[model samples]
Every structure is written in C-alpha cells, then in structure tokens.
Target: MEFNNNIPIYIQVIEKIKQEIVTGKLKPGEKMPSSRDYGNNLGINFNTVARVYKEMEMEELLFTRRGLGTFVTESEDRIGQLRYEMAKKQIENFIFNMKQIGYTKKDMIKFIETENYLEGDE
Candidate 1:
C-alpha cells in the first residue's frame, strides 16, 4: 500500500479496509492475515499492523476469535452502514472541493447530470 505523506498511514489502511468490506472485496467473516504477515506484505511495522487491527476491532468492523485470527465483521447491517458512511464522506469531500473551485450546489448537480463519465470508468 502506498503511503500518503499528508495523512497518517494507519488511517489510510483503515479506509482501504473499510472500502474493501463495503465493496464485498473482503467478504464478511473472512479471516484476515496475521499482523506479522500483513505487516510484511505491506512492508510496514508489525506494531502498525497491530494498531490497525486493534482500531478496526474497536470500530466493530472486525473481531478476533480466541486462538484463531481476526475476521471481517459478519453483520450485513453493519456493512451497509459502513457503505453509506463511506459514500456520504466521498460526497462531502466532492462538495467541498467543488465549492473551493467556485462551483455551487446547482452547478454540481448540473454537472452530474451532464458529465460523460464513461471515459473515466475505473
């Protein structure tokens, strides 16, 4: 995972994990990599990976089974909530950026309706 100097690395990791969960890329109840392996894979410190897991568990986005490993939360409702929150955040960011460029709410709505987004499909 590439690091963004402006933001804390742990935050970036948490966001990516949340996105994966919301998008179904990381299935509910799927066992996550052990902190050591995950740290190695991401070329980050083990403490960092541990911190990520701890924070996620605190958020109820993950759970750890004794003697087992951390897993993605299995609650569909929780995942749905996460999805909605992520989308809302993205929209808020978009609105802020558009306003910064002197675009109003009406302009944003108009652009959304008329823009050819096919060229930017990812």
Candidate 2:
C-alpha cells in the first residue's frame, strides 16, 4: 500500500485495513497479516503497523488472542455500519465543499451520477 505523505503513517495503515474490510478483501473473523508480516509487505516499520492494529482494536474493529494473532471482528454488520458512517461523513464533506464552490444540489447529484457511471465503465 502506498502511504500518503499528508497523513500520519498510522492513519494510512488504518485506512488500508479498513478498505480491505469494506471491500471484502478481509472478511469478518479472518486473520489479518501480523505486524511484522505487514511491515515487511509494505516496507514500513513493524511498530507502525502494530500501532495501527492497536488503534483498531480499541475501535473494536479487531480482536486479538494471546497466541492466535489478531483477527477481524466477528461482527460483519457492525463493520458495515462503521463503513457506512464513514462514507456518509465523507459525502457530507464533499457536499459542503461543493456548495462552497457554488455547486447546486442538482449539479452535485448529476456529477455524482456521471462519476458513478464512469466508475462502472472501469
């Protein structure tokens, strides 16, 4: 995963894990890559990945066992709800920015529709 320079590395790592869950690349109850393994894969420090995992654990997105390693939480619906909330916040921010730029609601809707169509074409 390419880390963005603008965000903290840990945040980027969290986002990568979240995206994996949201996209079904990582399923509920699935084992996640270990900090060392993920660090090696991404060419990052193991501690960074560990920190991200720790944060996610605090958020209840994952659970860990003493010797079993970290796994995605068993609550798939909870994860989906979290992703939905995150997407809603992003959409709200986008709408706010669009309004600031003088875009009407209709214009924003049309733009979104067009973008969705183009994305489907991909």
Q: Assess every candidate by TM-score.
A: 0.92, 0.85
Model 2 poorest 10 in a row by lDDT = 113-122
**How many residue pairs clash in all the candidates, one count each?**
0, 0
- The TM-score of candidate 1 is 0.92
Q: Of the candidates shown, which would achieve the greatest TM-score relative to the real structure?
A: 1
lDDT of 1: 0.93
lDDT of each: 0.93, 0.89
Residue 59's lDDT in candidate 1: 91
Q: Which residue pairs clash within candidate 1?
A: none
List runs of model 1 lying over 4 Å from the truth: 118-122
Query: Superposing all C-alpha atoms, what RMSD in Å does each candidate have to the true structure?
Result: 2.5, 2.8
Tens-digit per-residue lDDT, 17-112, candidate 2: 888888888899999889999999999999998998899999999899989999998997889887897899898999999999999999998998
Q: Top model by lDDT, which number?
A: 1
